[model samples]
Target chain A: MTTTSASNAGFAHGRALRPSSKVLPEHARGHNRSLVLQTLYRSGRRSRADIARETGLTRVTVSALVADLIADGLVVELGQREETRPGKPATLLDLDRSAFVIVGLDLSEHSTFSGALLDLDGTISARAEVALAGSTGEAAVEKVVALAQQLVDQATVPILGIGVGSPGVVDLGGVVLSAPNLGWNGMPLQSILNARFGVPVLVANDANAAVLAEHSFGGADSDAMLIKIGHGVGAGLLLGGTPLFGSRFAAGEIGHVVVGTDGGAVCACGKRGCLETWLSIPNLIERLEEEGDAARTAVLREAGERLGIALAPVVGALDLSEVILAGPTELLDGPLAAATVETLRNRTMAEFHGSVTLRMTTLGQDIVLRGAAVMVLSGQLGVS
Target chain B: MTTTSASNAGFAHGRALRPSSKVLPEHARGHNRSLVLQTLYRSGRRSRADIARETGLTRVTVSALVADLIADGLVVELGQREETRPGKPATLLDLDRSAFVIVGLDLSEHSTFSGALLDLDGTISARAEVALAGSTGEAAVEKVVALAQQLVDQATVPILGIGVGSPGVVDLGGVVLSAPNLGWNGMPLQSILNARFGVPVLVANDANAAVLAEHSFGGADSDAMLIKIGHGVGAGLLLGGTPLFGSRFAAGEIGHVVVGTDGGAVCACGKRGCLETWLSIPNLIERLEEEGDAARTAVLREAGERLGIALAPVVGALDLSEVILAGPTELLDGPLAAATVETLRNRTMAEFHGSVTLRMTTLGQDIVLRGAAVMVLSGQLGVS
Candidate 1:
């Protein structure tokens, strides 16, 4: 049961849950390799026979793939298992976590640049961060590079790839199309980092990164949505194992959607009554301080309702059952999330539908960086 | 050049278009059948070598598969193709439109149950309809059955399957979980239709069917979305070729998302300022009649803005570049669509990203029935 749950969790983390043969029939060798790697990474050490049985791969295929992975320094053979059910004790295999480390950058934070060295399991090996001091453009880019370099220097094994989660509309090429907060416009962050470190680098939107982290490392379900409500608001979507990269790679930009049409406060994007004006942490805090306590309570509740109004259609359209809010838990988890759940239930087919779960993100602030790790793992090593 | 254009169209229609070697790996035989059939269906008649070349399937494999298809009556051999090349003229093949006809039902439109016999290439052979004169429940269901039977009997070729596009929340099992318009709740439409007709049956939401039609037969882009603005307001989402069938089968239920905060019209669902109140055609028509000619245009514009306001986040969240409106082209294509496009540009990343296209559906009122055909083609025949 433990192994089964772990596999399920790992399935959401990376790759499809169904057997490769049943789900997709075109991929041959690459599919086999990913299945083997993901199995070892998620379910812990297992003998070749166990991996084969779990994945529905032939034992011969698993053994050969495992041997190749070991030779490629991705997997390693361990000592015999101590389980008492077998006639002969079999040697176990596991992902070689120490064989490579990934550099993960969280650039979506409000006032700081943070980077971490993450192992195969998405655990932080070391961390380096710096508060921004009036930097923009190349100056800010230099600061981010310095942070990544610090983490890169701390790597205790072969460097896999670097993954950065930044606040912007990132293209498939990892170009920062826009991030007003970070003062980046068309910055080729992936290429910059790749050239600076002479290694593969992947850059994604911070919310996309957080959702990826939630999906690949934090056991988020398929069709789950993670909304990061901090200084800004955005969302990351996972429909099954695939991240919904919209036509323009702008999926999950929920902040600027005009809501609460009574024309409340305006947003940075020059829109009135946007979810940004209602849901951002700054706006929430301002309402809390400027208005009375009743207003404070009311603002959070109203903001949650507005969010629910925006999401009700999405949930109705996508049949998404799980929604996770990533921000200050104190701010989002109380009346805000409760009101969101209430509004969503009232607006959608709640009676006829399955229960929709709304909860705070378990990973807290480390979500973006770990998501960066997930991107690197999946992009470079074929496993998350 | 014709062959090339056809390949491009078919490429947009089916198979994993990304180098075929990655993403989806396990749909081997299914993939090949679709590739070959789509090429023949869209590109018109072509020699076996041309299909093999376009699909990247080996000539021997294409020959063998085409031979099986011809035997199965899905393909037919035409006379030899004339060519100026030095080699002997090759035999051309085409999809046998008369070999097997699909029965497609459109239950989305108001006051009628319409069905059609569709060819393999999605061309309508014949149509049948029964007006619902204030009938509902069993009476309405009986009329729908009669319409389906008329079309089923009109299908001169071997019947492929029956596909119904109903206005409701359809489950994976083809049960109509809810359809207030038709007075259906938890109706086992698929099973009932299958038992009655003795053929495979598929029941999908009308919007879902329309989007599937747009994706499979209408030359839609990968991240295309089709919004059906009939008596009801809903959306059909296609991320690449995958339909977004949300967790509760409520994906595309956009009508009830509360839009206006200034207490306007109350929805039947007991929500104020719902997209339903603002966007439904009846509501729009009422506003036009209540206000004057200026108000007629203004209401449509405002409705479009409201629709855009709801979809800005979806476009932002899903990065959908192309959105099609399925309704009266005269109404949706003019000021309404323009206003929606304008509002979306005003709210989303307009300057920093690629342009978003908003246009009326090319399929007109027949989109849903054709979409039903797409469901059957993909489900029973595996060749959408």
Candidate 2:
């Protein structure tokens, strides 16, 4: 195995350059400690009292946890607050940005491998990508490992853990049950990566990871659905700021739901009338190619309408505030976006009226990778 | 208002008869307290130490909470375990079954009104049914209230709260957004009941409630989907032991999902090709009535097949453990059930390979009522 000098530097810097603090045990104490850290990380600078009030933890407990965090160099006390609230000024606490680095990996059919080095606050410090010669599981894994190593080598902070987002069903144990595009099944991805990198690894479905990224970085308030209209159609549901993973981890598999049960084109998954059969990038591209410019645009617009109809139940049930679209702008923008809005407005309860907003992802192609980094942060910090 | 002495007696007796030396809170507390109570309720009698270990709460905190509970006569300390495992004999604790009673009400078009009175542990102690005279919103609500009052009066325990499950989109505040059968739209149910009866009221979509009831009472060990096939086709999703409410509180509106884009019957909701349009009881009956006995059976079987096709994506994505059919047994049992199983097996991933079981609801006609009762229990005890 090649020695990852950058990984060592990141770890050393994370530990030495910042502060030497013992990691808390993952019990009740750890839960509170992580909550404090997360609050500071999310809110930028929150006083110990503010965290205590927000989290419902006692002020004494927050003080103790904050003291421990400060002693460990994971948090820093920034003197006193500038704003006054009719009382003594409170001491604002902020996360030590250089305390840890999270490595994120995104594996998609279009993009073989993309990796990012994120800090404690989820700011990407470094990134790298590798093209795959062939779109196969083995080839993809190999490229991912290499790209991960390169990204790790470039990191200047201490490495905390790694998170990977791949398509298909990912179990709690980080096993990839299946990825149709990669031709993978029952892949022991977590074990392999943990053994290789000597770090904790979390493997999540790409859509779920994307939602996490959006929830944390995109500033979604409460409930939202991140629809990924790429090679396939899938959704990541964020209900009350937490990603919802259904019993079989298929909560958001809207792609396979039959949109046109009879006489629709057969999907790659061998199903007729599947939403993905009509909405997937390849399928849409084929239709566009066959239908010409005006027809293609019309078809894309119609695809969005069908997608809206499909998602009406989701919106109605969850009472979400937004639907974040993550895909190529050429497909998701313009008429497609307008049609989606129209259908959603028509199908949903009028009380929701204009509550749900449909917007394109700001992170662009880097969304999956950023989401993976967010996943790592969430895992390490115990946010979810 | 006519005073219902029997209902008052039920509530008074249920609360006053509880053992005074119990160690669980009388009513729901904050998140942590509720988590502990839920753990005990689900797992059964366990020591405070064991509960702390299972729930990741501090022993001291658990002890304090338990003390508060015991004082309130909600939880009781059982005699010490006869067999000790190389440690101190732990005193087991359990929920006081007589502390509170939950009333569940189910109102559907075909089924006018049904209900059950459930104890703290979710054991149904009393049940009642009343015919619905009209399908309008006000008429249905009046019938439901009368039936609920009847069940409440017959109850031999103190009532804590009431839960109502109807076929519609319900909000957190117990308002029904729309129910085509009942002709309800934006009905303020919670406020209406709260005004009449000084107790908490929970309103949920029938399918959502069914999923919860199935998870807790239907012997479902993993994530499962409970499809309620009565006058309409609705689905309830239990994901990770919790009901998976989508973004808009309309997560399980599988009925409105278009199964056929063209040449399908128009739904009462003004949509075409809805699953309910093709597979609902009225539709099935109409097809059977027109086609004769042979075609009727064939249509039922075909309906099951179509359902399987519609549900294939959910199975593939969620890796669902089972699909429970609840409704008229005459339609869902035998050939229809068999056809559903066959289609599901064929369409899903081979590796899942007979993993998803197709079963019928054991509760029969009371499934919806019991589900509604479960919803009340969940809300009263803060489990959902």
Candidate 3:
């Protein structure tokens, strides 16, 4: 399926991205600083004067912030600009990609714990993975730490921070409240990583991470939602550019919502007729194995319809425009994708709305790692 | 029914209230100005230095902003505050509640077109209502204009703006895309009122307006959903203190979401399983009239459970903590409320998050009008 993932702020219609007249003076300078850095990050190399003119900041303020960035090893003085439409040739400043590396971990992979060392621009510099062997508790934690350490050791530059995307609900403080697959309950992942490496750490739900990755790198419309249907089903909702952490940080747990209603198959959550039971890859594959090729498409289409049923109210309530799915594209595309779009259109109020665009993930398997990198970038540099 | 309506930003957990470090230099000063005004609006009265301390603004900046407010007639200098700390007594500044009057219209009231003139603090200064007699087309539009003009004529203070909360799917630009009840289709409400009154005007769906009113006047949690179940069923979603007016401005059209699986009554939209078909007050009342007291409770409870099923994924997706039902307490409380809560618990990811608190609106019947008042305030002055 053709995917349309623009910036998260696109679907928000200038709500989240628009700066209002309700900020304080204390935050003004910081906001300007972040703005300057964001422009530079998004636009690649730009001179101080160019940034000043673009951001409408005084040359002096931009120069001062640039100085601070360079002093902090974030920006580097590059060669002179082309000197077009200026009195003098201005020296361009660039994000020093080699100065810092971020360690990102994706624990959502069913049988493996994957890690990657990413540069400032989210380029994967090094990679590592550990076969999980279906371990939980201390063993799972140990495997995660080992994978992180391997990526950390492989880093060729200063480690900016470490971000882990685990399966389950996570609190604002990066505490893993629960991960059924990992057998994790109230795991202090951030503290553990922070203490182990003596670096800043952020741990978030894998689905939330995937959404962040989509927003930062995958071109998600600002107020869009990302649903990841692998071994487990969960959603990542981005309102404006920021993720909706919900009141309890369990905002994106859509897998266990009852979809079958009349109780078909029992789910791992001890519930009959859950969304996960209908849509999970393992369950679908199992169902497909018993059916013919023609029946496979029908089964996947039914699963897609079920998924759409579970999400229709959400789309109706939130008016989220873009619904992106991430998983094995083969099973998610064709008849399944068509059925999902049909169901969504059938469910939402199409009189006022056109139709919600359905797309497949562009980042694919590396979505979580890139999302974790984005988490580190937002937490450490205040930029996404 | 117990009601809990805290300040709108309370449930947002400082997300919308906290000034982010991503604003532009052009918006910084305006932001600070809004911040100072918002503080005064929320905290009642405070001195310049006190505002500085609360807002982290310099004394000179606060004094300058306050002076501007006073000049604009949006604020007034009150008597000196008592010297609690060791310093000279400071004159306090307060929002001039009588400086501006907002005309608010509520079209959701069954068989009536109600209008009110409200002061800056949302106090109803004058009220007007016309029994609709189930009118539509040009007649309905004429009635709305007459009611608005009556409120405008009664305004004693300077009129700030007019806001209309009509029952429909309104686009972000204040166009009534569709209002089945009022026989409206693509009505340019904001433009019509603006041209007539020669002042600012905001037009929104009644449910959206109700949510906005809840957020601005009734102290709704920033991350909350308000379900307005009267003659029709609809919802208003507040994400990060702003109304979620989906990409096509159809964010809260929840009533039409398919709810009944076995295909019962057909909806007004030609759907057989819409939530509105099962849960609209008129339908519930008719069903109650046929049943005994025990059966009445069961019917309401079943309706509530169906509503909850339609909303569970939304609650799970948004992780919203506050769910407020706007309608008669007689039909919504007791068994209905309990069933809704129970269904939400059974459907949401309770393994990680706690139960979402469901409550009746504290603003009662005036929610849409109050919401219209809030729309005018936010549009004119960017407050709340």
Candidate 4:
């Protein structure tokens, strides 16, 4: 039931989902390798026969794939299984969870760039950060690289790869298509980091990365959207466990979508009543402070309602039942979450989408960092 | 290329796109079969070697699959390839487009249940309609069954299958979850039709069916949303050529989503300012009548803007570049389409989403019927 299991991996599903497409001999081989790794990753441990039976692969095929994985240092053989009535105790196989560490960077924070060294299971072992201090463009990029270097240096084991969660529309090739606050446009962040660290690098929108962390670790549904409300608002969409990379690689860029007809505040994108005006952290906090304690509930409710207005169509259009909110828990949990649920039920078909759930993310502030690790796991080792 | 080709088929992609899933020997056989068929379908005619080279299948494998297809009467050899070459001319192969006919029913029309007998290429060879002056419940159900029977009888060739495009939330099992206008609730339309006709039957939401037609025959982009505005407003989504069936099989049910913050007309769904209030044909015509000719342009523009407001988030969320409008091209093409484009550009990230195209569907009123045929093609023959 793990989200990152081969049954739910996002990297190859969306584009490669076409059944009419040919599955070459090489594709079958790669698919089988991933299948074996994911089976062990999901079950924690299994014998060759158990994996063969579960995946419908032959015993010989499983044994061969297992040997290859062990040679690559990706899997290790534990002691024989403890059984009372078996003819012979079979050897158990599992992922070498501690063999290598992954470097993850979160560059979407308002004033700092943060990085972490994480194990295969996404457990953070080390952390580092560098102050951004009003930096933009090249300066901000330098801060992110320095933080990643600091975390990479702290890794005690061989580094698997590096992953980054940045604020912008990132292309599939890991180019920062645009990030207004960080002053990047068409920056090849992944290539830059890969050259510097000489390891695989993967970069994605912060929200997109956060959704992966939620899927891999926080138990989010296969069909869900994670809305990350920070200095700016954006969403990450996972449909049937596949992240949607839109035609322009801007699939989850919903911050500038105008929400209400009765315009209120102008947005940075030059649109009035954009969802960011109502839901971004700074705007929500500013409105709450202006209204005082008596109207705190009202302000939060209004903001939540606006978010619901923006999300109701998405829910109906995607048939999504779960929406995870990654942001300040103190501001988004109670009144805001409740009002979003209420508004969604009122706007969408009750029998179909009435059960749509809105809740704060359990991953907290480390979600993007962990998700970055997942990207590296998926890209470098075919495991997430 | 042909949208229904194996390279773009949607049937198993979204659910079976997991690379970690095992591609059993049986799957490879089926995949290669589909590849050969889609290659010929896309090229109109191709030699076995041409298909082998294009699909990367061994020539022997393609020859074996071609033999099976010919035996099944799904393909026909059309003489040898015509060219001035030194070697022997290869035999040309193509789909047996007219060997079997599909019975397709469009039950979403306001006053009529339309049906058609279509070729494998989606060309209608015969048509029939049953007027529904004011039928609902059992009477409407009978009307649909009768219409399908009529079209099946009209087929000149052996019936390949039957497909129905009904107005409602249709489950994957083809049950009409709810279509209040026709008084259908939990009616197993597909099974009932199959029982009556002794042929495979597939049913989907009318808009969902129409979107398939747009993708298969109308040259729609892989990532597109077709908005069908008729008796009630709804949408059909295609991401990377795969139709999105949400968790509850209610994806693309956008009519009920509330749009403007300032409430206006109350909808049949008991919600004010739902997208239906602003976009549904009857509502728009009524509003236009109330405003008279002097304000027709203004009324349509406002409705278009409201529609844009409803769609901006969808475009941003899915990164859709093309939106095809069905139903009353006169109303949706000129002023409405222009305003929708303008609003979309204003509400979304300008640089990324500015090129999003809003256009009228070219398939006109027959879209759902054609889409129904496509459903049968994909379900019964692994083609579309």
Best by DockQ: 4
Residues A137-223, candidate 1: write the lDDT tens digits. Answer: 888899988998888878768788888899978887788988887788999887788778877788888888898888776778967
Off by over 4 Å in 3: A1-26, A81-87, A292-294, A352-354, B1-26, B81-88, B133-139, B217-219, B289-294, B352-354
Fraction of native contacts, model 4: 0.88
- Candidate models: Cα lDDT each: 0.78, 0.70, 0.80, 0.86
Fnat, 2 decimals, each candidate: 0.53, 0.29, 0.65, 0.88
Q: Put down candidate 3 lDDT per residue, A57-137, tens digits, no spaces.
A: 789989988988888888998898785685878898887877889899999989999999998788897889999998998
Of 1 and 2, the candidate ahead on lDDT is 1
Candidate number with greatest TM-score: 4
> Model 4 Cα displacement at B13 (Å)?
4.5
Best candidate (score: lDDT): 4
Model 2, span A1-384: residue lDDT tens: 111211211111111111011111333465566667767776778887798878777899889888887877778877899875687888888988887788988886575577888776667788788887665777667777888899778877677788888888777667788786777788878777877887777788899888888877887654778889888888887654556666566667677765534447877768566678778998889889989986867998988887775666555444566888999998889888888878776655454434678999888887887788776665665442
TM-scores of the candidates in the order shown: 0.90, 0.80, 0.90, 0.96
| Interface RMS deviation of candidate 2 | 13.1
Mind sharing the TM-score for model 2? 0.80
Off by over 4 Å in 1: A1-26, A82-87, A292-295, A352-354, B1-27, B287-295, B330-333, B352-354
Clashing residue pairs in candidate 4 are A17-B13, A20-B6
lDDT agreement of model 1 with the native: 0.78
Q: Whose DockQ is higher: candidate 1's or candidate 4's?
A: 4
Full candidate order by DockQ, most accurate first: 4, 3, 1, 2
Compare candidates 1 and 3 on DockQ and give the better one: 3
Give a tens-digit lDDT track for model 2, residues B1-384: 111211212111112211111112222124456666667777778899898888766788789878877876667998898664686788999878787788888775475577878777667788888887665788877877788789778877567788778777776667888776688899887667766776777777888777777766778654678888878787887654556555566766677555533447777867666677668888888887888986867888878877775666556545577889988889889878889888777655454435678999776676666677666655555443
